[model samples]
Target: MFLQITGYMTLIGLTLYLGLRPVSGRYFVDMATYYNYFQNYSLGAHVTSSKDVVFHYFMKFSSHFMTAHGFFLLMDIIYIYPLYLFSKKYFKQYWYYSFLVLIVSFSFYSYGTNGIRNGAATSLFVLGLCFPENKIKTGICFITAALFHKSLTLPIGAYLLTLMYNNPKTYLIAWLAAIPVSLVAGSVFVSLFSSLGFDDRLAGYLTGQGNLDVPVYTGFRWDFIFYSSFAVFAGWYFIIKKGFHDTFYFKILNIYLICNAFWILVIRAPFSNRFAYLSWFLMGIVIMYPILKQPLFKNHQLFISKIITVYFLFTFLMYFVYYN
Candidate 1:
């Protein structure tokens, strides 16, 4: 009980720290953009951003009463609070383990600060998954997430598809096949994805035209792909090899595979990390869910502690080494 309280308070404190960060683009990619937009909207500027219609109006309305820093606090609340709720819903008293996994995930800090909208939407997506039996609640969460960031369509669509067909083996096979396919015909997938017209920015990513101002990896990222493969391996190991069976795990694993497979096919695109995040956001739950639920290892507590250390170490390394 004490640890849980401590964890929750710590996460709450983190939300505040991130939200109130001094507005700058040095590392927080979208922080300055959000600040400028909020200032303009506060001055009675029109909210013309239709891509995420609801989110734009949200900012327009929020700016009327609060400074940009206050708005960031609100958004950070939206982004981080849901992790607590979702972990509580699933893990109960043991929720701290899941919460710790999520906060330390490689993309967690960056998403909370830089990809603010995506962070907010993905948090909603995780929360929505918590109440699968309640269609009304789930639908509302999913819809709101989409409005916050339309890129959520991929995962939400994958969830709907999972309802229709929940087959992990097939998805795993396809996910594996995507590597060689991507190596040989990555351009084909790019053209096909751009044709879908999900977002105009898809084209920019495909043509390496996105973020000319922001330097990012455009070529094949074998290291990143290798990093992402951990969830795939973990899922298959628990479900197929060890014969773990749970409806919720099935749903989560399938969605992770489907979404990660799409990223695999487009792994060479510019800002592909953004695409990878659609799946990476769920990596914590995907890998830790089964382990926490069933004692996969003999010394479960020690195992979890070690896993937490290794997981957070990835973020630590990225922050200091790669990000530097």
Candidate 2:
């Protein structure tokens, strides 16, 4: 009964938070384009030679704006259920607390509004993380995500590497080492993407085109950084003290942190803020599992949780009332 209440409360809270925002209707535009492109499969063949027949079929069948948006919403909801199952199975003791932490985090809002493929892909990746031992099943999940967005190839490739490494320490060390390389290679990566036939328009948007002084709502806020750092520390404590041994999730979290840290140093744009969502999403699992199981910081936990909740509420209200 408590679980049911929490779940409904979460759904209501998310709905109220997201529903009140002015729908820019950007997703509708993208969906329409996708639908049109799929409808012209021969044109799709001319555009890209890979078989995305399933994606094409879905778009073809669900051509209307309402149907497309409904599909997107359904995918978003479906993606989170596996996360719930994973949280319950592994961190049963702290599932509610963890869910609350995730709900209060602004990552959910950012992803929902972004209307980009990466956001959807990340959700599916989380679902994949929930089932580590089932490699074949996990591969299918990763492949499905790639169909939604190819950038996920990075994390999916990292998952495969994690399978190769017998020790988490090795994976961590390698990830740390790769951070500097990735930062330096970002320009090369951009060029490579351009050469590989990705739309320059899309690439420019992702990397942030020439600076325009715009009212940025999200980015590397000092507050977000502080909270993320605390969450990372909490994860470290949990793993070391409780011997949390989910190597796949740990590898994903470590890579995410390293990449975000590198991005913070190298990139400067509100668009870069997407990395925070990835960071916080994984951190939710890392931080909450420990807190749920031990409750060692019971008094401090509740106090901090309440403070965080109030802060999010204030920000949400302020954004709607003043910023909007």
Candidate 3:
């Protein structure tokens, strides 16, 4: 009882710390961009988002009554509160454990700081999926999520398609096929995808034409391919080996597989993590949700203790050692 209360307390403090961070490009780069946008809107500069209209309008509306810091705090809430709600709904008593997994995810902090719109939208996507029975509520959440970040359409569309013809093996096959295709086709895939014009930024990523002020790497990113394979491997072990045929779990696995495969096809693109993140955002949930939901081991608590340690250790090593 006391532990759960403390967990919530810690969550509140963490949220506030992230929300109140200073606006600086050296550190939360997108926060500075957003601050600029907010200032423009506040000064009647007529800001708009052709696709992310809700986001621009929200900025426009918020500019009237809030300081940029407060707006950032609100964005943090939008990015984080949904995770709290979903963890509570799904994990119940052990809600904090699942919430902790989400917060500690490799992509979570970066998204919140660097890709604020995607962060908040994906969190809402997580919350919206919590309501499987309420179609209207789910639809609204998905639509609103897309309006905030159009890239959300990839996962949202994948999820909806999975709902219709969800065969895990089929997605797994597609995911594997993408690897060889990407290896052989190489830059050919990039040019083809860039021509689609889904989003201009996406085009830039595909074509290595990103607008940047710092050196960026572009190549066959085996490190990321291995990282993404974690989900594919874990899902197969749990579902195919251990028989976690939970339809919802299969859907999540399928969603991750589909999106991850699309990312693999564009593995050599600049800032491709932006594409990989569509699935990486689901990694912790993919790996942790099943373990939390089922008593797969005799001493499930002990198992979870070890899993959490290893999980966070990997995140720590990756961020500090590899990334730094």
Task: Report the number of the highest-lDDT candidate.
Answer: 1
Summarize candidate 2's per-residue lDDT along 1-324 as a digit string, tens digits. Answer: 776677657765664444334334353334444434644643334344344444555555444344434555554564455566666666664465655666555566555545435566777777777677787777787888778666566567656655565454553454445445545565554445445654443354345662323345433345555555665565555566657666544675565555445444423344545444545556566555544555455596675477457647854864586456
Q: For every model shown, what is its TM-score relative to the native structure?
A: 0.96, 0.67, 0.96
lDDT of 1 by residue, 1-324 (tens): 887888878887888898889888887868888889999999999988767989999999999999898999999999999999988888888898999999989889888898898899999998899888899999999999999988889899999999999988888898899899999998788778877765666567666776534576766788888888889998899998888888888889889888988988888777777788999999999989998788878888898999889988888987899778
Candidate 2 worst ten-residue window by lDDT: 210-219
For model 2, the stretches where C-alpha displacement exceeds 4 angstroms are 12-23, 26-57, 64-69, 166-202, 205-207, 210-228, 240-249, 298-324
C-alpha positional error of residue 208 in candidate 3 after TM-score superposition, expressed in Å: 1.8
lDDT (0-100) at residue 151 of candidate 2? 55
